[model samples]
Target: MRCETRLYNALNDRMRRSHGVAASQYEFLRYLRDHPDTRVGDLAAFFAIGVGATSKGMDRLEGRGLVRRVPDPADRRSSLLELTDTGTQLVHEADETFGAIGALIQTALDPARLHDAAQTLRQLLTALEHDRIGTPAG
Candidate 1:
């Protein structure tokens, strides 16, 4: 757990230093890039995080001019998110960084072990999902 935490902390720090964004912010940007007009609530769901946390991440991205929160045409009170040009660039950069990390991970493990770990983690997550830990509020 400490190793995982350290890895993520380093990843986040590196991302912020190099790209001026956190992985969560990059994820939100990626989601918006792919989905174009997704709502904040939907983005929260996609990330499996609370709406407030997603909103806070979005606020940071918005401040960086990487994302825009426009009124949803279907719902006046709801905001639809989209990636700006700067966001597209940042997302691409993050993808490269992630790709490098992925390569490193892949090289560190045997193929069968990696596959087994992935399957085990997926099963664990499925079980946990049923138990519903840390469910978000409306």
Candidate 2:
């Protein structure tokens, strides 16, 4: 738990200082980039966050000219999210930033240990999500 918290804190601190974006915000942008016509409700569910929080992030992204909200043709009340050119650029920058961090860690740690740690973390996350959804793990 301490290790996870420290890693998250370090990542957040680096992201905020370097890109003025939090990890969750970056994730939201990435999702929009991948799914160009994604609905807001879908995004909220995908992120496992409340609709209000997702809406607020959308507003912030729109205010920064990174995302545009367009009304769905089929459903006038629902909106689809799409990334703008600036958003694309930011996403690329964020990817590069993360890549650099990965490279630094690779250089600092043993390759085998790092791989094992990553696998362990992945398993933990999967188990946690299963617990969150009240699913019994086999």
Candidate 3:
């Protein structure tokens, strides 16, 4: 958890300095870039956040002209998200900044140790996804 917090803080600081966008905002933009026309409810589910919170974030993104919401064709009550040209450019910049940060971190670690660590983390994630651990007992 501490490691996760540290990484999140570092990414947030870098994103603010380089892109003028908060890390959370960048995340939302990135998702929109990849999944154009996605619904707010889908985003909320993907992020494990509430619909209200997701809507609020979308509001901020819309205010910045980074994202636009169109009435969903299939669901009139909800909107589909799409990234603007400026938002797409910002996502590219954010990707570069993230790559640089990743390279900086990689330089400080031994390749073999880093590979092992990555493998272990992947295993842990897979186990969690499969509900191999942390499920409440009946």
Candidate 4:
């Protein structure tokens, strides 16, 4: 917890300073860049957050002209999220900033240890998902 929080703080600060976007927001953008036409509930489920929180986050991004919510033809109550051109460009720049800051993590841990940690984390996440740790996004 201590190590992750410390690293997250540094990453967040640098991301905000360089891109006017928080690390959390950058993560959301990066995900959207890779997976377009995602719904808010889907994002909430993936991130293990509440649907309300996800919707609020989307609202902030939408207000920033970074993303837009399109009505889903298949689901009247659901909307698909997509990054705008500006959002795409911003994410591209932010990716560089993220990678540069992420070098510190690589420097701190050997590749083998890092790989082990990542695998452990993935296992933990899978366990949580199986157990349904958080409230459902609905």
**Candidate number with greatest lDDT:** 4
RMSD of each: 2.0, 4.1, 3.5, 1.7
Alpha-carbon deviation at 49 in model 4, angstroms:
1.0
In the range 21-83, model 1's lDDT, one tens digit per residue, is: 776676678788889789888887766788888888888888889988888899888888888
Q: Which 10-residue span in candidate 2 carries the lowest summed lDDT?
A: 129-138
Whole-model Cα lDDT of every candidate shown, in order: 0.80, 0.81, 0.85, 0.91
Give the per-residue lDDT digits (tens) of candidate 2, residues 15-100: 77888888777888888888878987778777667777788999998999999998899889888899999988888888876676
Per-residue alpha-carbon lDDT of model 3 for 13-127, expressed as tens digits? 9999999998889988999988877988878766657778888999998999999989899989878999989999999989988787678668878899889888999898777
| Candidate structures ordered by TM-score, highest first | 4, 1, 3, 2
Model 3: how far residue 107 lies from native, Å: 2.0
Residues 66-123 of candidate 4: C-alpha lDDT, one tens digit per residue: 9999999998888899999999999999998899766888898899998998899999
> Which pairs of residues collide in model 1?
none
**Winner on TM-score (2 vs 4):** 4
Give the number of the best model, judged by TM-score.
Answer: 4
Give the runs in model 4 whose Cα sits over 4 Å from its true position: 135-138
**Candidate 3 wrongly placed segments (more than 4 Å):** 129-138
Question: Candidate 1 at 132: error in angstroms?
Answer: 2.9
Q: Give the TM-score of candidate 4.
A: 0.91
Clashes of each: 0, 0, 0, 0
